[model samples]
Target: MTPPPGWYRDPKAPHLERWWDGTAWTEHRRTPEVTAPVPVAGASGRAKAVAVTTAAVVLVAAIVTGAVVLGQGDEEGAEIETAPTYYTQAPTTEPPSPTPTQSEPSADDPAVVTDELNGITLPLLDGWVRPKYVAEDDVVMTTDGTYDCPADGGVCRHGLVMSRTVTSNDERSPEALAKEDIKEAAESAYDRDTIGRRPYGGMESHEVVKSGPVAVAGRAGWFVRWRVTTAEGPGGYVQSTVFPSRVGTESPVCVRYVFDAGADGPPLADMDRITKGIRSVDDPDGGGGVGSSVGPGEG
Candidate 1:
């Protein structure tokens, strides 16, 4: 039997309690009756206080593999904290809900980076590491090290792979979405980031190198790739991949890749390998899994 709706320790942020609305996690959150933080060595009491406070406001990053690194600041040498926080909702009883579709964290596996919400898992290849910042339904993996960013006087990774279930756009064809996303993906990766971080010294220009049909998780898809030239560092390659998800409602999904065009960057072939390795969490063999009976439209 499904547990009745109640407050429970959040599977992601254990110190705080999240409301379990019988079937899923809700927006409601409250402090636990008693909570003890997992202590970190070298962290001052003040820092720990700040971390606890900051975590409450932004329960974004969850462990795709290990800990999520939260940057304290950009004061030349601010300490970074690798806190094992952020979570899904956990039920009270030992026996859990039999229906996997009841929760977004149903397929969660800490041993590998899996986006249960998106119903897909990207391959964890050598030279790549689970990123420090991952939001709900969004997954990102990047190179293990960073390089000096020429424009922003910051550090930048030479490679990146990110994925998310597409919900904003109404376009149904994967090809159309892929074609449209290539430009934005290039700008985001090479030119500037959300916080105006000019990591690649700002992209100078870009040209399409590849565009065509592809297959992901046994679903037909489309991908568009570009070679970008930047004002600093080595230029990079960026691509936008779109495919229909095997999850509920056949939702569209988007995955993007970035590789700095230099020796330090991941091998270009790795992109193809990664794409080929994409598989649904429910369909590890890439058989596309079973489609949801629930969908939009009039029967």
Candidate 2:
């Protein structure tokens, strides 16, 4: 038979009563009720108030307990809405090592070469081979490569030269001397007739690339750069500088570099250092002031 919708003695626990809503047992439960407290004589009001307050507190506690029990009971029979969580670890990776690259030669670390005969010292391009001083001429250093002129058909050895002379009583400046040399070279090898239009040697053409004032041996000087034609290739020419001695004794000095027309020549910056480093010294031993000078022809 169906249970009535009211509180009934619990079959599982004899000391407690549970709610039966016709077909199902509810979460609500209660213990057997004890006899009510009787008011003492002349204190009925206080006693009744105390009894009412205790009942109210018990009722609230029962309601909270029922709610908790209800939640637990439902959890046992109901399907949970939460999904099962899963995690996957990612693979650790590292960046590739940087590729190795070649480092450029430092510009500040210069090469030094000296002319012992003229008592002159100058900086040279790094890796420059000291020349053999093959002739009485002013060759101090030379390149390893030799040029077979495509047009002229002979080897034009390329190198650096140092020329020095003590100035006499002439008051003319170094700039004037360099200008005079240029004029002389133009008139001697290059014809004054056709002049600026014709190509020379194997060079495609020539140009007065640069001209400026420079200082050498603590005295005023001039710097000149000339680009000339090679035989069906690049042109080569002489770069000369004129420096008047600072001792005031009128000593004119010159340092000239003759570069063969080619792509393999030392860069302009190195040439500039070479020229700027030229200074007069009192020693023919190729002194260590500029750096230890290698014995003649020693690189």
Candidate 3:
């Protein structure tokens, strides 16, 4: 009888195994085929062990890849967070306001007047010179240059007269000049031979009066009067103080003149004319004259 065409083995229990197909057994085996014992019970356990080892290797590989991806994500996030941002703001402003103007004096001002003396002309009689006298130093003298009244009138009514010297360049300010003149007048008492010096003859009292704001030589000046007691003489004593209109290192010069009040009479009436004629040369728009050009230097 013929056997099946697929692989077949001998049915008899033998140490050798043989393959047969259809009607014939193959003679291909040069050596006998050895058969292993059948492992009936442990076959499933071996298959399970192999499956567990393969699963463990796959899990380890997946874990390593997930760790690398997570590390990359963290690095990228840090870089983004550290970057800088840009921004801006607005500008400020301010507001505005107005301005004002100024004014000056006019020709109609009443204090103005004019005079001429020794070929010098000036505006006179504003709030300029003050009248006062110094009682010390040299005796001053005067002759009227011109007057509102005639010279023959023994009364000597309306002209002004005075005497003084430019003592020192140190006397610059008006106050300093005044004080120096006064000190000089007091010392003049020692010079008895001088014209206004007379011994006081037991007179009970003395007096002095001053007037000014006169213009002389284009500048402001003052007038002064003094009445003093005589140590030995008879009539009331009188003296005059005249200051130069221009101020200088040697200027605004002071003059002291002793007069016979008995001869020139009281000086009040004449003082009015002197004060009225006083004037100031307007200061030049830029600056004025030779004095302005000259700077201070040793005398």
Candidate 4:
């Protein structure tokens, strides 16, 4: 009868009774008893706020996958520090070029053509063998001829009017008349005992079968073609000379010709037509003109 403040067990409940009230335990009624106090129902607090927003969305997706794997390992360590490295260098070139040379003419080259023999001329048959006497110390008296050139042999009779001898009687000093006309043409065309018996006789004994330098009329001359070897062999003698120092003393003259030996003649073509037909018998006070008379059968 006294178990009424809280839990009690009887009627064959075999000893169960809890009734303390001054401090704890009191939901009475034995094993069939349940004390009520759980009452939060805002739909179960919205299912506990949906499990705390699914644990803060799995902790912000694991801190954004550890900041995208530490920004892909800091972009693979800045792409291995911006890669590029290789070695072996040597190559750079340029150098090579030069060549050229050729030119000749000079021995005091005065338009080389010092006449020894040029084209022979004469009053030449049409002028019908004139030129009879013309000599001023040497000798030129033409009156023995019959030349008809159709290549030698057509009709060439004979010819001679030799004169050109000046061993310096001071032929009015044109350098002693060119050293006495080259020592009188080396003593009448070299015959040093028949040029010491032939065979390239010391280069045909000072061979100069023709030399040149002539103006003639206006004074100034030098022509020569000398060669001799008798018994009808080598014979070519042509001489020309003119010296008057621009007409002061006026008396140096020589012209000769004797081309024998088969005479197809070519002593510098007859001493360049006798020093280019020497002329000038007038006009002398220096205005040029003094080489007069030349007649190895004048042309």
Candidate 5:
């Protein structure tokens, strides 16, 4: 026997309903009425409207529950990424780490060494270097860098120049100071350097090589030079040159030089040449290494 015409589960889509006529399935189909309200057989208009509203709310609840429960797993099924409410959380994260930094020095160039207290600049000769973190504050320049002292002590350099403003002494004459400082200059540069290495062993004896008037930075100056023989290595020369500064209280400024007499030394003529190259820092053509009048930090 065949069932009478009515709505029933659809053959093609089990979740939907279809209508059957007396003889065959009809084209009419709809969602299964799983959550639709059921009304009393005698319900009036207002009662039916209330029932419909109730069903809508229940239908929404069922749909949310289904999504939470049935939507769990991925290869199997993935959980619903969103919640029943409006707000959803953004993925958690952290910012990238910060980097560190440092600064490289620009002291490689053999630059002009300055005497700020005296308003003058010293010129660098070939093979000379104005190094960094190596010489003392009073040291303005040196030659051929440095090496292990033959004495097996500290380090040693073959040639050096130093400068200082004349203060703390009652006598201000350039000539007196130049003569007086020669012995001390020789002792400091050859007998023993700052680090206490006697690179020339020790000053065995010295004789005045020259004593005369000179000029420095456009000012009259006096200088005393000595030829020093050491107990070790080749002999060398030491000079103390002093002049009145062109700035400040016109205080005298003293410049000293020590040159190795070995084959590797700068020619003795370079001492006079360097003195001649001295110029006022304020001069238009003076103190130009690193392209400008740049002051170096204490070595």
Candidate 6:
């Protein structure tokens, strides 16, 4: 059964009066009544004065007690206001975002070199040195492909060899010269092949394993390659490209990119990259004057 909301005697302390705030017993307590002191006729004036002072003290204490009881009644059924509790979040700690590291250029990347004399630029691989002796008309020598090794007892190391030659025009088509170069490779053994008018540097030039027409230094020219085998021995391979001067009717400019096929030379793709990157002074002004000509190996 539900109990009615009213004051009742405290069950825990029967002798003391406690306020029942409908739901529970409160801390309010009723104290016994305090009587005010009365003055007595003491025969002496001093005694009467002392009695009056005692009465005044008792009255003041009663007033203070009454105020405390009123304060308790006002606070009844009211929530006690305590200091608000706060919880601070721990400082967020996160691993620093990994800084993306960039990869360094490969050491095997070829060094770029330009011949200021003829304004020809290209990439040269490591260990390939410039030849000490160069012709007056020659712009640069890519050094000898064969490296002399005394430990091996002779020119045992063989690789790619490249050179540039500037000369007057021979007045011959690249395709015709390409065929002629193959024939003249060796009288004993000669074979001629042709790839007609392949695109090179926004232009078309005849091409073959033997030879082709190419552009270098802003002039059209023929590139010829020779592979011959005679009864004597392997005649080796030679690749030569000749370009006529764009500025005048002077001699043609020739550049040779050659290597012995049997000597474990650079791959054909690498060769194509080097060749396509060739640039002359008259070429466009970009990529350090290196040719941006798209070729067989280009993407």
TM-scores, all candidates, are 0.57, 0.47, 0.32, 0.23, 0.58, 0.40
The count of backbone overlaps in candidate 3 is: 28
lDDT of 1: 0.71
Tens digits of per-residue lDDT for model 4, 1-299: 11123332322232543343433334443454333334446657767667665555543333211001123446456421111111122222355554554423232322221111221122221112323433222333333555542231233323444434333465454434643465454443322222233211211333446556666556576655555543333444535344443233455555555444444443345445544543332333222222123333343
Model 3 poorest 10 in a row by lDDT? 290-299
Global lDDT scores for all candidate models: 0.71, 0.55, 0.35, 0.38, 0.71, 0.43
For model 4, give the 10-residue run with minimal summed lDDT: 79-88
CA displacement after TM-score superposition, residue 181 of candidate 2 (Å): 2.0
Residues 1-299 of candidate 5 have per-residue lDDT tens digits of 34456665565565666676745667798886665467779999999998897666554433321012356457877643222221123323488787866533143434466656557778778887765555554667778677665553666677777777767587888899999899888898778767676766788999999999998888899999999988877778999999987777778888888888878777888889889888776665544222223243455
Which residue runs of candidate 2 sit more than 4 Å off their true CA positions? 1-111, 133-136, 166-171, 183-205, 246-250, 282-299
Count the clashes in each prediction.
4, 11, 28, 15, 3, 6
lDDT of 5 at 227: 94
lDDT of 2 by residue, 157-189 (tens): 554454555344365677877765654343322
- lDDT for position 141 in model 1: 72
Candidate 2: lDDT over CA atoms?
A: 0.55
Model 3 lDDT tens row, 1-299: 23344332232322333445445455432234334434445558777666665555553333211001123446456321111111122222355554554523243333322221111122223222212232232211123322221211212111123333454675545544554454344334312323443343233445555533444445445544455544443333333344554433324545444433444433444444543343334344311221111011201
Candidate 5: minimum summed lDDT over ten consecutive residues — where?
Answer: 81-90
Q: Best TM-score goes to which candidate?
A: 5
> By TM-score, how accurate is candidate 6?
0.40
Worst 10 residues of 2 by lDDT: 80-89
RMSD of each: 26.7, 24.2, 41.3, 43.8, 20.2, 27.8
* Residue 204 in candidate 6, Cα distance off native in Å: 34
- How does residue 256 of candidate 1 score in lDDT? 91
Candidate 4: global Cα-lDDT?
Answer: 0.38
TM-score of 3: 0.32
